[model samples]
Target: MKDRQLYQQILGITTPWFVAEVELDLEAEEVHVHLAHQQASWPCAECGKPCPLHDHQNERTWRHLDTCQYRTLLHAELPRTRCEEHGVRVVDIPWAESYGRFTALFERLVIDWLEAASQQAVADRMGLSWDEVHGIMQRAVKRGLKRREAEPIPYIGVDEKSFRKRHRYVTVVSDINRSRVLYVSEDRKQTSLDSFWGTLTEEQLDSIEGVAMDMWEPYIDSTKEHLPEADEKIVFDKFHVAKHLGDAVDKVRRQENKQLREDGDDRLVGTKYDWLKGRDKFNHKRWRAFCRLRRSNLKTSRAWAMREQAMKLWDYCYPGAAENHFRWWYRWATHSRLEPMIDKAKMLKSHLKNILTYLTHPITNALSESLNSKIEWVKYTARGFRNRDNFKTAIYFHCGGLGLLPAT
Candidate 1:
């Protein structure tokens, strides 16, 4: 049968019902669909009036799933209705919303592929522009947000990551147990956290028993202010604490290495140098240097002594020695003549409650970091997000764990 006749037959326009027909133009590499209206009247929304259908308008085409080698376009002759009570209005169709050219299924498919794949990649595969794919994703995000209004998230982890060379940072919050991002803010500030506080109630905050953070003042301040009576105790993650000490140790080691190089100690440059990496990864050579420094009894070897002290500080962090370790550190800090090391130890000991809590409940903000990695991947894959809403939508759809399929 001819394409036009086939389209008319499938559309069933002769019966004057509300349905659409499909026409496959194989030779032209196009599939055209026509939506027909059987009723010529619509009741006014504001005023009860049977509006008469005026005339068929221009063809509105929407991209659809491909048919074999041909691309499909859903074309409909949208009509305007003239009502006595209300002004001229566009007729509503059940297959697609007014002013929306794409079918619901087609939009879902595009958004699904976009959530799993990059915008550019989806555009390239579907022969669409990046803008179109992004538009679909933005719409999907809005829809998802509406559906997720009643979701209950108990434990949330918040952290920040640098973007655009550390000048611009984005704060990300995630569900720790579910391993998904709940939201992302423009800045890492207390105000940024305030944006989502309304999403949770006091009961929810009180339910949180633990919050893992990296010893950032803003996060700590915000949590305290927002959840003043929360049962959640702030746990300074062990990884970050260890990182701080490791960084300090590395700085000291580098200074020592620089001094050796300046003094023409080339014999101690290579093999002897590996001992100064960090206290955590200290080798046999490092242990030997530490022993030598502890036993040297030389006032000039302060750096070597400091390195030994740093090693001892790390040694106190060994597993299964929590009580003994705290006692040892307390005694060392109280009696030590080295004021600098003692000061550091005292500062750490002051937060011993949180530190010991970490030993017992070892939950970290690593899930938040992992979610940030995925957000970074989305940012890089798209090269950039021009629309903030679309960027947010993509993030929520991809990582919100709402069980929403891209095809939905």
Candidate 2:
């Protein structure tokens, strides 16, 4: 077959659009396939009404899939139609989407490579600029998010991810059951989380069974305002509760370690991490040493014991039993004379209703945290995004579990 016919077959070029000419620049190592349109009336790009072809658009080119190790490009002077309602608009082409600088197949290739490597790396390998690669990513994510179904995720998580240094953050809402991000907003503000609730339908909202999140007041207030029976559905993540207690134990250790060292009792001097570590984390040697420390009459030990007991409360299969366990644990901490433990215990008490909901909902932000780690890896691989919009785009592109592919 001739090169034009071969390219036509290769490109699956149809009646209205065909490869009119083919040029191979051996020195440049590129294949150029120029396209042309036959005499035909075309439908309006906006309203799909049949209209006369008024004129040809300015010549445009698209990066296409490489042909036999040679970079390929498609050049076309697309037809324009004067629609009565929508005015003169460029008609859609067969080989590429409107406004796209790359063919569908080429964009698909970029999407596949992007999932495995950083954008810069993909751009370098694909012979494209960083901005071009990012534009493809933006378009792919936009397509995927637009195509996403209105189905509600039965269990969800709302979490925060650090944007850049200096305490900047973005809120992420993920489908806990499927482990995909659903929404991302600019900050941890009440309005930030409130935006997510607005996207759900009454049916979608009603279908939501639970939301696992940290007890950030903004997030709590937002969930309460949107979800009915929010008390039962909002599960304060168990890990967050554990973090609160862990922090309290660390504070107790710091103060007591100073007092013990000043009195020449150096037992607590270098055990900062030991006190902070979970019980099972200790190996045999460290476990034996930690056992002796816990056996001592140190205020930090008592505080550690309270923290450990509170963590164990998560094992209860029933909410009532768990609540009772927390009450006993709370009483112990409040009367234990450790101000840090007392303060943390009181805070947990105030959020106890939602904390105990974990027994029934049995959901946590574990997957959200896991996805956050993946986002951190993406950010690190990209060496950090330039701004929040770019960062948000990167998050949706990488961690949203989106079907980010051009329809080739």
TM-score of each: 0.72, 0.95
**1-408, model 2: which lDDT tens digit per residue?**
247988988877788888899999999999999989785689998988999889998899999999988899999998999888888989977678999989998998999998889988998999999889999999999999988888868999999887678588899999987788899989899999999988888889989999999989999999999889988899999888888888999999999988988899999878988988766898999899999999999998999889889888779998788888988988888999899999999998998888888888889988566787888887787663688888888889998888888775
Error of 2 at 316 (Å): 2.2
> What local lDDT score does residue 217 receive in model 2, on the 0 to 100 scale?
97
> Looking at model 2, which ten-residue stretch has the lowest summed lDDT?
377-386
lDDT of 1 by residue, 1-408 (tens): 245555454433344533355666778888776656667676653464777777767878777666565677767777777777667777665445456656676776786677678888888998888778777766666666556654455566777756544566666777787788767777788877767666676666656666777667777778777765432467776667655544444454455557767987543344333434445676788768756653654322443444444334334455457656567656754464544445556656666666665544456777566676787787677465664445566677777766453332
CA shift at 208, candidate 1, in angstroms?
2.4
lDDT of 1: 0.62
Cα-based RMSD of candidate 1: 6.0
